[model samples]
Target: MATFTTAFPRGFAIEVLDVYSGPPRIAFKFRHWGYMEGPFKGHPPHGQRVELFGVCIFHVDEDMKVDKSEYFYERGNFLAGFLSCPVMRGN
Candidate 1:
């Protein structure tokens, strides 16, 4: 989380598109938007805009406390976007 905060100093935003609840689990489909302003995953600051879709699932116990969470997103798309930045052209 801290890396994200530093990487996208402009801030990141998530828009929930859909949500589903089943017993003790809740799932969400969302879109994320941000700009790369700092190094990320060893890539230098590129100052490029990034938008991606992802899904997250949260599991809660009987006490209503979240015990686990998982996130899924397209790595290819994300890496492609990062590599597309003009600043990454030489490398």
Candidate 2:
């Protein structure tokens, strides 16, 4: 998370699209978006807005604290967004 903070200094906005289940087990779809205004993995920022969509399943204990979580998403697609650089002026 810290690494992402530096990459997206303005922060990623997260939205829960839908809740599929509740209680001890919870499932949901989500979207997170942010601008690449800061360095990412040593790569310079291109100031491009990026968005990621995914689903997650979480298991909670009796106390309602998350005990485990599983996240599914297109890793390659997300990484590609960062690797793509904007065309520099007069380059």
Candidate 3:
């Protein structure tokens, strides 16, 4: 129940690994999922460049805005949402 935002940096895109059924014991837990199979199906895993790790919680408003009324970074694991963040390197 805390204000949250996409972890992706400006203009940065994340190569999605997979977005499966939620309620993970790690940290971020969503009651439902958006992305699915078929057009989303693949060999081993399935998902697109997940730059923005969209999460569902009572932190921010439905639009993902700050709301002091209901803001809670459960377990203090904000970074966990970005665990699959794209790895980048430049010259």
| Candidate 1 lDDT, 48-82, residue by residue in tens | 78888999998989987889989999977766768
lDDT of 2 by residue, 14-83 (tens): 8999999998999999998999888866677888888889999999999999999999999877777776
lDDT scores for all predictions?
0.84, 0.86, 0.29
RMSD of 1: 2.5
lDDT assessment of candidate 2 = 0.86
Clashing pairs in 1: none
**TM-score, one value per model:** 0.73, 0.83, 0.20
lDDT of 3 by residue, 3-91 (tens): 11222222233333343333322123232122211121112212323323333323345555545322222542433333332331111
In model 3, residue pairs whose N, Cα or C atoms come closer than 3 Å (at least 3 residues apart or on different chains), thus clashing, are: 1-59, 1-71, 1-72, 2-59, 2-71, 2-72, 14-51
Q: Judged by TM-score, which candidate is best?
A: 2
Candidate 3 — which residues are off by over 4 angstroms?
1-68, 88-91
